[model samples]
Target: MKSHLPEKIYLASPVWLQNVLVSTYGAFEHRRRYSGPHKKYVEYLRKNVFLNKTEIADLQSKLLERTLKHAAQTVPAYQALNLGPTPKLTDFPLLERESIAMNAEAFLSSKYKKEKLITLFTGGSSASPLKIYISEEARQKSYSFWQLFYDRMDFHVGDRKATLVGRKIQEPDSNNPPFWRYNLKDRQLLFSSYHLSEKNVAAYLKKLNSFQPKIIEGYPLSIYRLADQIIQNSIKLSFTPTGVSTSSENFTQKQREIIEEAFGCKVFDQYGSAESVVFASECEHGNMHIEPEYGVLEVLTNEGKIESEGSGELIATSLLNEAMPLIRYRIGDLGEITESNCPCGRASKILTELYGKVGAVIINEGRQAPTAAIAIAFEYLEGIKNAQIIQNEPGKVTVRLVKRTNFDSKSEEFMIWELKKMLGQSLKISIDYVTEIPPEHNGKYCMVVQNYYKFTVPD
Candidate 1:
């Protein structure tokens, strides 16, 4: 295991500082025997989080006899290694993040405590920031999902993934090369989500045109925006991307449609967490599937059952990443089950409709989608580099534009009429002119946020 002292959890610098995150975990040791009450807790967790009734029953029978035996032989926190004359497993106790943050050194396994281990930190947007402590074995096993999932999609790690994000805003200069790639188990090219301007996009496009990656991943809206530019420039998206993926935020159908036109590829939406846990992933058939191999999905319903589709809470219990197991963890996202199965041969569960990420559903009024008439009208506008329309409330909308100063009132009138012809007369438009738009709460910029969407956490 690696030390947090040399990590970048504490600063904005190239290095990770230890203080930014601290979470104590149940400690383990190699070449050790457990003799205390470890069996009881492990059995309870296995039954509640990992097994079904039959499996639990079968496990219980074995556990009935070996609970003491297993604990005495394996778990370190136990009191007696083999019920020895005097054991102190009770002294260690159940581990947690708080304790780890207090004493990181004592928890490390003696075998590899001095070895070099790759490290990482959590984004902390879901609940609270956590300092993740892992071993080379832990890191590889914990992060093996994407690699396997992609291989399932027939794409290899050496291929490039198109990333559309809205994090850092970088103004162009030859000093820092606009493109960067890293060896994160697989190859990657880091592009700036901050510089998607008309000129910047054209330049970004030219660069991508040369790199010619085989896949795309990142923000949905940014990819959609790039698609708008591609259409305007008469750019051919015939480049065969193995697949297009999106995450870190909610994806609107409108944005997905745009990405399809721009990338000329199917979009795969993946849902995950810093817990290094897998939630759900989209299949080739445009259907989202859960990797139950990694965790169990529990949909908590309300009293109504009236709004029926099993919509309420999405709670999950991870299956594989056991370095630190989270039991019945609340994801805080609202969703429902879809009875339909994908034409693809994937054997996984499905969800019907998903309202954006975590508490985003809100009541509001605003322009919805462009009618076939508006899409037709877009053909007439000139100097129109790219655009995004967000309905804030019942009668208000925000328009993000990247165009030349030559856009006069006459042009505005034409654009307004086209919008009116499409969204109908009930909605009003609010144009916010800025060099570029910034990402929302997370590092992702969702194209649409229900004008007044509000989410409440239960007390």
Candidate 2:
């Protein structure tokens, strides 16, 4: 996986070039303007986040009542319920992704025009792939909530930042140093998750140091890999960020330690999804608080009963997104709620733990590679029903793939090429064609498993 490209190439590149590209292409390609409602919602959330428990609950109740009334009146899917003037939350039935897919039109509000609707595609990290639509207002509100969270981290608009999400910014087969791009619109540096291999860590570090971002935001797994590399190489960064925000995947305790140690800053972990049904973020005190202004989050057991203070599957109902209201939506994630109050004075519900993807780390030549690297490699390949990576020993890896009807030798060749590009050619890669990929014993489908190397929080 070692690229012949010199590391100095990235360091030698002028910062103005990145700025120019971001200002031109980034602005034209992906530009979003916050609507009036979006700004109002953000301001409201800033005030509400510090409200007392009773006030917060009252506010949520009012929003819930409004959302339910809107869904009953405008959404075709909820019309059959014949909800009364004052409807309880339990009056609506639980909604699954299958139901949404089968009757997507029924979920749309007749109030919004076709032009206002925007379709969003999920990364298929979960069991079900979704193509959901939201109104422009809903999308902006989501962005507003993110801004509110960033503000809590002392981050303001137009701050120099870096993101390590699952964006395919690099060629799968290209072995190069510039595995990142700059977005001038938001002044953000976008890093390619596909190129975060052991061999390219130094190059990534070089570029990141050159950028000197004030905030680093990305998936926990991807950020952890970069932080781990920095620690292992004893790399001294010239610039220090105020905060490191993680989302999309689970932020483990071990990862928090490594990131905090490497960056000399706090790691603010966030738990939210594209569905916009539920949202939570870590406060300055490191307490994970569920934002009541975003949506109604309910922890339900397997029997479909609500739990007050325990671990269970998260069921959410979005109060925003009037264009396509999702009531009693079963967001496929696990969480634990606690009655303990946050000392930070935010009376919002506290989440003791939140679990999403448990991706493992593959050890090769004493260098650890995150499973996200492998996942991003095969993300573009077609005919993959489901894919899993398992590493039981050093220097060897097993790829378990549930292939679709079109899978062939060429598909295997493509996969091998992508894998070798990230995991060096010296390691042995065994592909196992299976009929199905089963979930773990706990009913969670782990995309990556490493039996040889286990990461734990240091005592």
Candidate 3:
């Protein structure tokens, strides 16, 4: 019998893992992460050595100075930022997409030449296209924490693993070994997230069962969708994962419930982006704990004030990176600073809830959220592949679907009846079948798009 695992683990692994490995290696030079050096480092990190607000400000003081020193020598952008010495965090130049596009090298620090940087190509999650170079130390720091974060989450480095994630569309050369990371001693099944057509999902599932990874991570939407298909087929599975983590996209309540039901593990929801920082992760009880060790996050209101003590727009500063520091960088997402602390007793700030990305469209009418509740009806309906609620006009909605089979009248009526029960019958509902559902220009999976910004209220 094969084991079943969700297909989106790679996106969440970077930040947490980067912190883990660096912290561990620093503590003990020659120890395996699960045992000697790694264990001690995890203990020290979890208990001691986290920077608070004042401490972060102090670190930023030195970091900004170092960054300025580097930029003046290497980065053209900063010399051009043309600030006087002793620039405050706000004083540091803001490198939005426009600034980079205008003059890419202008952002480079003067200290290090462009050739010195180990460049990492960044496919901007937003519409922008450009490659950003990160310093070697910054790159190491970016990946260092994986072992440490896993230790924090109880995943030891020595533990064998399988990673189901998005990979290069072309299959690896057959002559090469099946496992890609040759240096890493542990075993892994590196399956491609893109090749998950229904025809091949079973094959992937079978391979995952054989690999039996202790931890599985990936984007939320794709993982849940694959799990839904696996569960629908009623294939017997024995996937006893210690943890399942999600990243790159928002994890809705509906998706969480379905993921748990399908995989039988807690969903460790991770938040952040590829270019900058790894902000938070869900504890056992579902509260989000931000990575206060390396980054500081602030919540600003729609009016651009820091109003959401717990939830608001996230304006973050990455304290760890001196390579290309993102000082008070605005990564668009709505959230609040949570007053509620977790029962687990970690003192890290809890990010109560994240309302997806700026691209996410939550269904609502007036001040009330009818679309929010209706969206929950899509937990894990067997045989129903994927569903998206799109509103083209007022009072009229379209339920676009990517189906596994043609919906008979009875099945369609049942779905409509369930939707009505959730979204109110007064709202006109139309169902459409398509070979594929298109994403918003930003390459984000938008579950709903209401052009008029008005939706039906649930009676």
Candidate 4:
């Protein structure tokens, strides 16, 4: 019998081979052209990041005007509104996920055909699943913005980077050696979030040591787990990254401390969504600076009025993504904006505070489980009005649900199966039916909560 394993798994295999395969596949099959739009956007971002406050705001206003005009002219949803030329930002109605979900085609531009546009989905962080459409140009521009942001830490394209996110690169049920898949095109080592147990941490560390990534990027919790294991076991690595970049989930202060201490580098926390409507990244001085070049972020009150300066719901209008221009889209997240300039001298708007979904760290038999695994299980499920995963004790999880009247037993069965698959089969899952799952006293609804134990990095 012949053994079946990736060539990269072999000790004798050359690393360049993996890179070649990834690049070739991405260019030909994925149709990813990393030159034209990406380069243009990168150049634009490089220049825009250093602009003064007034200049940045002026740039955003021009971009917003163009995007709003384009949306009003091309999109069916906007066309019905009868918005006048040079209409105020408030003149356009606020867009919601439900509106897009109900009629996605109406949101798309008439200029692009359905086949020509790229479809993307975003529900990892929230209950509402949104199906978004973007043009090839928009997709590349989005990637370019990320590249420019990463460049702040001296990271460039094709740099040796490791990522730990929700991608199902490895089989969920399989417990094997290659818990990560190497992407040669981007020179990225994609690690499986599902295989981050105590028994598998050694394998993950071994791969990281071998890969010797110059930069590490992933969800804050996932990276913290790896850092925790390394620090707790006193494991030394062959290489140290320049910095660690985190996104997708809320990067808490404690997680930041542990990651920085363990990796011996600063952690850059980035806040963005799949919608491409708003973007913010941490600067060298640790201030979260909103990129006005990307979008116009407005902190609005519950009554749809803009806040002069304080905490409120985040509503954004994309300066990019003209393919499906979302004007004043309610992002369903809370944050605060400040007029204070960063010590780093960047005059971009500052995000003083962000109160997004900070998922919990569930413990099963002394092993840390990724909250993403639980979050993903509920993705695209019907009749789930809202849900929350609470872990108060080890090996036990309480799922509080605000289900629709039509939610059936089959839905419950599927939820149980999904929970058991990630959290061990021996885990105790209690489904608690509720009329409503309210937010904490601070008015933030954290989907996942872990109260059992706090995993920390030792001095």
Candidate 5:
């Protein structure tokens, strides 16, 4: 969010020039992520996966000690705690998002200057974005985990990949054909989630056939919409990926089924946060395994007691990021960690179930829509600060929005039009422009709140 091109400049550039800019940015990212320590880190993870339970625990303890020592010595926020020469993870109090946002500078290490670190802004979940900083080494280490996961799925970095995530390659309101851009350096084709309507999907499919990417990675709902269309029309894809990978949103079994059926391959769903504190990837055996090498994950109950094998909120400590080290940070997501071991021969912990932002389903009469679909409705819309969708009854919905000073009738009209294209014409949609959309009781934002069940029972 912090490093994106200005809207005026992006719109003013010609299509070819836009591709050039995208490729150039992609090349920079490729060099930053894949150089130096990346390969070594990936190799370490490859062998670390097979480590036994006791071995992993020992590795995590050492990593935790190192991270805590670095933070207590260098970070001003942790220094105030007076954590002694040897302190446990719980010695530091649980960190809240407000604590980070209010004193962001205080959290930074004294050794690193703000201008020197790579600053990243988280998107899609909160009304206010949280800025996180890290060194290039930490950034590359974080990316290595993802590359290792992709390797498990038979896809590697620099391979031809078609990404259906939220990238503003094209205008939100445009109805034209090319709703995607090519990053030649990374061998990636970035597609805009805004223009994935029925009218434009054929063109998208045509392009996919020609590009023939080996792997497709994106939000599950965005990919699901394409798979749903393929199934509905009984259309066969001209190409098949080695496998499909999904992240950035909660994935459902139904969505996985449709995607796999359409693509004729397995669907691997991975869970991670932009905060870089925790990561979990699905194995070929279809189990979600939490890599102990990345960080220490603790599932805790409402009373702050750790849950050994059941459902609770996830608390994690990052072993990677020292620039702004977060120890025992409340990740604001819920999940069930089971004691059951994965048959895939990995000793990493298994997450039996995980939920982020609830992934609530909005029902319009008989048709159901995921929250990710609703969020994509506002993609590339410049004037919108935040938006939320609420469905109280079937076939009726209300959208609450926080708009910027430049928000106009055109922005609202395009949003409504996009919503209609996805939900249906029968969906009675209403827009309410407000100052802010507050977070829920758990301090996390829900993109879609479904009260349809409270209003009436299903058929």
Candidate 6:
């Protein structure tokens, strides 16, 4: 079996040497992700963001045409369709994860050799892990989109930042301080999400106070857990970040509220995928605007027809990533497009609702209930740090919760009452209290889990 030598070496080394090794790797990544055409792409994105809706549509159409032409010419998967020049976007079939995973190489561009392309493994938060390949230029350009969005929040390249994502910087068993490591290249302090707990949270807080990062970015669950610690302890930090950015997880409104209250800043949520298919970011007005230059995001109904508004599946077609173009990829997300214009004035498309994935929906009496709607049960209720609803049998759910000191039986009863109002009173509910709720292997929290999948029959 193939082994990760660097990971083995890092684990064997002392903590100080491990920090050195992490910084070394960080330096290498910094040069790779921000080098070459990254700056040029950032400049283009900055200018592209201000275009009117018509101009944005024209640019997307042109880019989409170019991508489709390249895919039809070079990619084995798309070439099979013989998509003629000037083929409409709808001409391509909907791409699913299974199709890509079963034959990933067929999707690669014949123009590039597999050995030269950069390979990436997704963390498998919403679905099974998938291996994706991209050209070096594609990788760097993908980073450029994020760099441009971060610039809007006054977080520039080389700015001091703190990240609380999936990276296991510290040993899981180590019960000590310094649950983080620094990367001098990007001036980033990488916090280990695995090590976050009530016992070690004070250390995390102290380090955040001392580091004084200009921005904090990470999975929403990790950041929310930290924010919960701060609020529960009533701790005040010495510094306030310019902004707090969250990605890689389904961020809820309650999580955003707690994070903003704890950090004393706005919580900006960015929507993108390792697939590089779609990109969206929250603006100052709190609207999530899709970056039309990055990709075309189309919301489709259950019948597979496109919808301008209302919640439906998100179909994404990449304008970038020429090395392995994915057209009309159903990325397993459910979203709602908005008709109301964002006051921020960016002419790109708007997403008013972005539920994590179709799997997040809970079912009762043959009807699917969005997790967002179920989550409203906890709204305005005190003394609940975290709650997760698990469904195994039809009309039955087990709610696991971590409670604050103020929690009482009344709070539990109120939550149950509120939940039944939406899920139907016939739904059976049970509560399980725990010291804490653990995150998924990828460090993302899933608030809703359905163990049985035969809820909705075929149409």
Report each candidate's C-alpha RMSD, comma-separated, in the order given.
16.8, 5.7, 14.2, 5.2, 5.3, 12.8
**Per-model TM-score versus the true fold:** 0.53, 0.81, 0.61, 0.85, 0.84, 0.78
What candidate 1 gets wrong by more than 4 Å, as runs, is: 1-120, 124-127, 165-187, 304-309, 338-340, 356-459
* Winner on lDDT (3 vs 5): 5
Error of 3 at 27 (Å): 23
Span of 10 residues, lowest total lDDT, candidate 6: 121-130
User: What Cα-based lDDT does every candidate model obtain?
Assistant: 0.47, 0.74, 0.53, 0.76, 0.77, 0.76
Candidate 2, residue 320: lDDT: 74
Q: Between prediction 1 and prediction 6, which has the larger TM-score?
A: 6
The model with the greatest TM-score is: 4
Local accuracy of candidate 1 as per-residue lDDT tens digits, 301-378: 665222213665555544543333333444445567544436775535576556434213212232123111122223
User: For residue 392, what is the lDDT in candidate 3?
Assistant: 62
Off by over 4 Å in 2: 1-25, 28-35, 361-438, 449-459
Selected candidate, larger TM-score, 4 vs 5: 4
Clashes per candidate (backbone, < 3 Å):
23, 2, 42, 1, 0, 0
Candidate 1 residue-pair clash tally: 23
lDDT tens digits, residues 1-459, model 6? 113356557868888998898899999998889998999989988887778888987888888888888998899998899878767877899898758765779999999999998877552333233567888998899999898789768999799999976544644546587888889899999987655656778899999999999999976766777788788779989999999998756656676788899999998888888788899999998998988878888888867687656668888888888888888887767778875667888888888887663235566654344444454466434466567889988889998887766779888777776566455567799999988878665334577787864422112
Shift in Å, residue 347, candidate 4? 1.0
Using lDDT as the measure, the top candidate is 5
Evaluated at residue 458, the lDDT of candidate 3 is 16
Query: Candidate 6, which segments miss by more than 4 Å at Cα?
Result: 357-459
Model 4 Cα shift for residue 272 (angstroms):
0.4
Model 6 score (lDDT): 0.76
